[model samples]
Target: MNFSYELIEKYKETKGYTQDKQVISDFEEFNSGNMSKIKKGTRHLTANQCIEMANAVGMDQKEALLKLAIEKSKSKEEGKIWSDIVKKISAACIAGILAAASLTGQVVTPHLRYRR
Candidate 1:
């Protein structure tokens, strides 16, 4: 949910030309007056806003959205991979500990005993 101010600024500079002032103003007006208040600590960007901003910044909205989506998906995939690796390592460690305990005849219970 990282917000890239650099990307926003770059888009603004490219699209906020003199001739595009009216469009930019319209966008600002729409955002400030009509769009719902954004909640804190949330990463939510309206599709219309993205399109408008992209239009203002001389970039394709679909491309920007696609890039953002791809980045998010990649991060999620990486996290899942890391989580899987951690689970495997934890399981292996537990298995090793159990094996060591068995080798040392560390049986747990008053009712049962290790014959070997």
Candidate 2:
């Protein structure tokens, strides 16, 4: 899915990987053929691979997985439902940060990371 591709791309970008093979080599479970297939959108990554990439890119694992679910929805109606969930999850995370920051007398900004 596109979300998986983005996670993989983000991981590669952060690691300074110049080619798909570099990423393939980095993961013991990955092979050049599969990596190429994934990059070309002919194949999908396993959940573990997605989690690994999410970690490498400093993304929240739950959000990354939710995004993958959104992309994997079987129908437009289902995808819309997933998309709404992701939006609510993201908003809740931000709201929680703001609430905590308020209690601590600190200003929370949109660009700030709640985790990390």
Candidate 3:
């Protein structure tokens, strides 16, 4: 969940984004000081900021991106607990969607509903 770690990993995964400054340039709001705080785990990103990070990194899923943000805000054990909660939430969301579809006599694929 550490944003610095995820951001660093994304920097490595993305082609031609080889520097922290380059990554900062992709961010709409992050500055050098904010980046430093994020790296040091002293600052937290908001939900919208997390979504922006996901888009900047070309990640397709905001849920996973937000999970990283959440993880950065907690201790190791707390992060693990948070992950479990996320899993449960994700599962419940899917189940609810499926149940709703079934009640309405519709068959829907979860992935198909949220493309891109």
Could you tell me the lDDT of residue 34 within candidate 1? 28
* Residue-level lDDT tens digits of model 1 in 47-114: 66666667766766656565444433447786576556656766998899998988999956478677
How far out, in Å, is residue 104 in model 2? 3.4
How many clashing residue pairs, candidate 1? 1
Each candidate structure's count of clashing pairs:
1, 0, 0
* RMSD to native, candidate 2: 8.0
TM-score of the candidate numbered 2? 0.75
lDDT of 3 by residue, 1-116 (tens): 46655755575466466667876676678688887777777776656666655666776555756476565645778777777887898899999999999999797656556668
Candidate 1 runs further than 4 Å off: 1-4, 15-41, 71-75, 78-116
True-structure lDDT of candidate 2 = 0.81
TM-score list, all predictions: 0.35, 0.75, 0.54
In candidate 2, which residue pairs clash?
A: none
The CA lDDT of each predicted structure is: 0.53, 0.81, 0.68
Which runs in model 2 stand beyond 4 Å of their true positions? 107-116
Ranking by lDDT: 2, 3, 1
* Candidate 3: stretches off by over 4 Å: 58-62, 65-69, 72-81, 92-116
Q: What is the per-residue lDDT of model 2 for residues 65-92, given as tens digits with 9 covering 90 to 100?
A: 8877777778899999999988897799
Give the Å shift of residue 4 in candidate 1: 5.3
Question: Judged by TM-score relative to the true structure, which candidate is superior, 2 or 3?
Answer: 2
